[model samples]
Target chain A: MSAEVVPLPARAPSLGPILSLTQTSMNAVNQIILDRMQSEIPLIPALAGHLIAGGGKRMRPMLTLAGAAVCGYQGTRHHRLAAAVEFIHTSTLLHDDVVDGSETRRGQSTANIVFGNPAAVLVGDFLFARAFELMVEDGSLRVLKILSSASAIIAQGEVDQLVAQRRIETSEDRYLHIIGSKTAALFAAASRIAAVVAETGDAEEQALDDYGRNLGIAFQLVDDAIDYDSTAAEMGKDKGDDFREGKMTLPVILAYARGSDEERQFWRDAIAGFRTEDEDLAHAVTLIRRHDAIDATRERARHFAERACDALSIFPESKARAAMIDAARFAVSRGY
Target chain B: MSAEVVPLPARAPSLGPILSLTQTSMNAVNQIILDRMQSEIPLIPALAGHLIAGGGKRMRPMLTLAGAAVCGYQGTRHHRLAAAVEFIHTSTLLHDDVVDGSETRRGQSTANIVFGNPAAVLVGDFLFARAFELMVEDGSLRVLKILSSASAIIAQGEVDQLVAQRRIETSEDRYLHIIGSKTAALFAAASRIAAVVAETGDAEEQALDDYGRNLGIAFQLVDDAIDYDSTAAEMGKDKGDDFREGKMTLPVILAYARGSDEERQFWRDAIAGFRTEDEDLAHAVTLIRRHDAIDATRERARHFAERACDALSIFPESKARAAMIDAARFAVSRGY
Candidate 1:
């Protein structure tokens, strides 16, 4: 059967005001990252330029800028902080592609595929180092402490996912733990750094940090859900690619737990056995749908989105704060 | 002619003192590392324990301790600093093995090979994160600054080596540049941190920093030299493994440059063509040896060693300082 391709909506719900606010905040951060990424090593500068120019969603950086703005940060260091956040994210992507042996990302050839694994790995390291250098320039040991911890958490999450792949008993808690480490840790760090940078303490800092973490969790859950719901064309990669790589994301984890004995056996064979036949793909998708794993996963995402929005209650009502809440909602509602 | 297996001498001129000193320093550092590598995550503690307990050469950590001692550091933080240094090195090895797709390290199956790549990668990150956490406890921005920078340089070096692997004209300058970033940067950083932790200023700091850098370069030169000299049995891997991987270490780079046009053509085909047969290995080795690549490489190693010893002149002559000097010389001459 031919799969239906769902185009990303040109207009996200009420995105006009939100985009303008996000863009204004993000522009300052983006400019700083570009400027600071310069290096004497030709390759370092070249690769940095390529990555900065690559047009990532800038989700984490935007979160950082928005978080600081909501807390009334008038200082310029937020821009540097945001850029450091993006560099960390980008560096991870470079290394991630190498680890996964992936050849493409976001419909473009992966850096590893284009630049080769070693270039991707080393360049990733360059970005990471550059990020630290940028952070040090800000001279906030508190900020440094937060970011270093976040980086470690992010690495741990990726490692957890690596070890847990294709294991039948991977629980929802395990899934949450992995996603929290890999994805939410950085998001939380980015926003928290904004708070630390701005010297906004107590309830406001905690609120903003919670907001970032929840939003990140919601974002990743949505991503995992989409992997199951979307096709190769819609997702810009093959359907069940995660399964092919022996990854058991949220939907699969849920389905495996809820499926019949035969269905459970199928997952064991299909994922663990490395079965890539079309029949296996069709069957796996059917089982996921039959188990209503998609809806269940979406509910989890919405829960996190709501929690993210609720975290903004401590912030005095402002356009920037409101936009952040909207973005959290929009993250869950985007591909619906 | 049957190849003669030249055993590492039981009592080489410098090995006895060097080994004894390194052993003493390493034992202290190892104790500190073991005591501190704890975490809330049971997996983290377990995995870290496994890795630290796996008995690496601890060359990098020893460098940090020796650097501190030679610089006349009496502080206890050097122990943590040494452990931090080792953790970073160990973490990199875990990731490096995964990236290189190798299965053995230090004459044992690699963490990636034994535990699988995901575990190895994540555990490596765990160690990295743990290192930062440990460093933060020291409350020395100088150490953090040096370490963070070293981390970045090391990653960049790995990337540079990745790109440099297949290119035939990868210059000696480029080789040094890559090694400096990848290997020597950490060595330099480890020693520099030791100096900082000791509160040594200016000349002494620069001396130890230079000592670390030169020693690292010498160490790598010996490593590259040995890649051509050792075998699968002796090295615990195949001879020409680097050649097989299309890596152009110093010997191959020199041989290719110095060989006859026909010999150069042979190398070009062997490297570029992905040739990995026994005959290809034999020819590559023969060409490299016939061209005096080994001798030339050894000379380069000696130069760096001499430079390392020269860097120690700033310090008052002492047993610890003498040992460090001997270690530099031993880095070059021990195997030869």
Candidate 2:
């Protein structure tokens, strides 16, 4: 007997499914965020609210909510933990702006630029401490460990990126390691804690962790790809911030490795901070395009995204699982 | 009954007693510090060690150890917690240098000046995270809440001070409130956690908190006074740093408040950043000394030191209690 072949329906990969899936829980998390970010010091909330109320996607906390939904967690504990996750992310963003001297973020003035670096730095610290307070209130040692370890990893990753800056010889392995620590570590922790709250078994926890971690890698890869992609829309960040800062993201790493001798000289000069003019950025984009490095980076992201989706295979089929799978695919499809 | 007043022994107050009281436990705390501050990132440890290994006196951690001793607690948990206290202090100091743009600290180039501001900021973050991780390992929700709350307060105090900077109208009350948060909050938490680890009752915890809190205020007051004392020995920090930073310390507040019209204008211009030359600093010192602001600040410190010692009266008399009392007295007596 001949086997019948089936064709699946095609649809655009969008964040709609996951966002809607977790919307109610997200509102609760947002409420927790607003309540906890408040301090007697007015500037704390004012400066934090500038970015928190700004057009952030709240992507990390969404992972926690969605992870909990996928795990069939009925309790409200994830709400506080998710808020904690968002606070940690926000704290890092504030400090990141200070470190990068970034003037704008999310189509608005960065806290560092608007409030000044000292305020930004101190407020970042306040938010970080607040994040810990939220976790402590949750009263889970496991959650505390997951989040605190991730925080240290994120800080180390930041320092690693700083050390790698202005050096053209940074490899893809090192780049991945940095992003894994700085970005994926938090993502993994945010998702894993959902299982902790749900009392899910070790296998299920690992599944969620793998899902979040791989998705984080995919998300960051696409972000780096978009930085060098000429056809990409404005990312609400300076179009060439990565190049200007001499950051060695995956696109640049691949482009440099695949370049001609003269092109290699250009990459070295650009990454060494010798070429920062607009025209120099344009030329860098051209070189990146010539080697199809953006496409290669996206391809790498696709690999991780597929892994992210496959990680949820251990779970029974449900709308939450399907939405999470779409979220991974959406991460890879971003900046198209 | 004849009440005989026994005059106190005519000996200079010193940190010697407290240092000896906590020496054994402090050694363990130091080991934990050296171990925990390390990371796979070489620069993390290198930059952190630059400040940690620098002669910081480890005063905050000593409070934790001494509080444990005063509580008659026999456990190693306080060792890790004490190290965590020191980490928090180190983290704040590193960020403080960046915020103040300080070039030197503890007789050495600051992490910010040596490794760069970005490194200092990121490394500060690493140590802060590491501090939480240590608390998590100790598995005390109470300690976590104490330290985390204190940390938030400390950050708020820092931002408040930043807002008050260069404002000539800052009152002593406001200055006291700022120092209470920025300096004493951690001290209170550090001492309180020892009671938590010892399972001491609430009364003992409150007493230790009061002791550390008052001592911290006294310590900071002396530090501020020493900055303006012409006869004071070099205290390993730049002598005129607070003046140049326009920090509204108690001495500055007192001097500015008590100045003549022309001297008030000088104070205004100096704080407003118009007067920053060495001679300007010299003139400012002269004005502070002329008003006896240093002595007044030290007198204020003495009040807090008395309260700090009195806070320990609830505990039975022991070497630990006497040493702690001496430590408080020494805090007020510094720079004599």
Candidate 3:
């Protein structure tokens, strides 16, 4: 927990525009984040600080801030709410490192590695509780309801993913459902909360939620594809991490569905058998490319990005609206 | 996640009196629990069900139910709140087992051992979400605030415990604070929330919280003492679990303080060094008895029990009131 978070690779240029657009609210959100993360226990702030410093781009929180700006929210409540969103996200990252036994995340040693699993798990719970505290202080039962349910759904999605961990036969529908709940639900909540704070009508709220949701799905799809894309090293993770861990991502599922009998057997042997030969990663890559799995996955991302853009059609000509649309493009653009 | 929970030992007798007193609402709370735990992802329910089946006293939830009754409330909202209390307790227990790497609880397999650590951790999170869902449905900002703060404090206490884990130099004040936050905070929240539900005045609410806080401290003190007592097996867990784990409970602190120089060194080696000699437990028990540490610990519990009873004096004479007082007695009665 005492470990300092290593800074990320600059700001990942793709995120710069949207971040620059929402810079004011994002800065406010960051201040609140820094405030809520403090604790008398040095380890808590240390561990939380480590993750915060690891450079998440604060994407979900940025969504909250940006969504509020786009919805014309004038109050300071969104700052606290945005902080809550980041706390929840960071909390899950801590627990996820424990659950996944992951040692590295965001190109830095995960908190579980630096602080130990027990510290990670407990601090994660602390952050979660802090998130609830923030929302409760906000004094909106509706907002509380939205964020709390999203928290539950995100957990359910993680559990669902664990249920699918090594099973090559996990359905594509199940994959979509997992990503939607685990990733997109929070995004939707982040966006919708802005509307709630702004006292906007349901239509506008739903539009923002749709934009966030579709963007979230696209974001995760692009993330999954990047692991298999030729430039995975540029993504700051070792290529074939999902494969070595027997993670049944979209590309692996697609490749399995489209591969020939021998290739299917190869995947079964490599994935189910937990084989991590250097050539195995290469062969898996070869088969995925041959089956055009990465292309198809990115295509799915593009579709969702389009949907995200479509959800913004109701917004007036405004900088906030345009940046959100560009944010969708940024999500899909990372798939190389 | 797919594993069915093994049934618990026929219910422990200690909880019987409180259980009988709060029978009706407890039953209603149970129904809500069963209903809310249902999830399409069978794994969520499966892991959660494992912990639920492990036969906890459900004391915290029962406090919520009973506290509401003692406050002269007749509404059904307490049922959901009580269930939320249970969910929070169960969720922490799930994560606790993983953090402790414990294999058994309640004379049955712990959820982590039965469902796997990842499943236990994720399902624990799901239950937390479900608990929040239950509270949000109740729609009380005060309840949300109380419970959420308690949750955060509990996590802080756990981390403090982890930090204090092999250190014999941990002060008695630190130990009490740790236990107060980790164990008693939820109890206080559970009790205080019932008042919120009943719309009781702040004085009544504070009294109930005091009652629960004192009772909870008493409860944990007795439970810790029982581990080193000869009757630990009757308590359903192995004797010396805490001692082996180097937990700095009250008795241990007292024994360390009162021991001779040689005996103090023994304590240091056995606890700080994680060295468990075959005779160490027996010798420690002998010293604890010679120092009257267990008796002193029980005395402390009794003091708290009396304080708890005093807190309930504001209420009128009634069955609920009597039972509340009796519950305090029961908490301290488990020790020698």
True contacts kept of each: 0.56, 0.86, 0.84
Evaluate candidate 1 and give its CAPRI docking class based on DockQ: acceptable
Across the candidates, what are chain A's individual TM-scores? Answer: 0.92, 0.97, 0.94
Q: Worst 10-residue stretch by lDDT in candidate 3 chain B?
A: B10-19
- Per-model CA lDDT versus the true structure: 0.79, 0.93, 0.87
Candidate 2 lDDT, B104-166, residue by residue in tens? 998899999999999999999999999999999999999999999999999999999999999
* Per-prediction TM-score to the true structure, in the order listed: 0.89, 0.97, 0.95
Given the true complex, what DockQ would model 1 score? 0.40
Model 2 achieves a DockQ score of 0.83
Judged by DockQ relative to the true structure, which candidate is superior, 2 or 3?
Answer: 2
Grade the docking of candidate 3.
medium
Ranking by TM-score: 2, 3, 1
Tens digits of lDDT, candidate 1, B1-336: 999999987754364555676576677778877776665455665666666787666777777777777777776788787888998888787767777878666566766676766566567766777787778777788888888888987877786777676778888888999888888988888888878888888777788889889989988887888888753126544456688778878998999999899998888888785678888888888898899898899899899989989989988888778888887888888456
Tell me each candidate's RMSD, in Å, in order.
6.7, 3.4, 8.9
lDDT of 2 by residue, A163-227 (tens): 99999999999999999999999999999999999998899899999998999998999998888
Model 1, residue B228: distance off in Å is 2.0
Say which docking band candidate 2 falls in: high
Error of 1 at A152 (Å): 1.8
Give the alpha carbon lDDT tens digit for every residue of A1-336 in model 3.
Answer: 699988876543266667887888788888888898888888999999999977777889888878887887788899899899999999888888899888778777888989999999999999999999999998999999999999999998998888888888887888999999999999999999999999988998999899889999999988889888875547545566788888888999999999999999988887785678888888998999999999999999899999988998887878888788878887887745
TM-score of only chain B in every candidate structure: 0.91, 0.97, 0.93
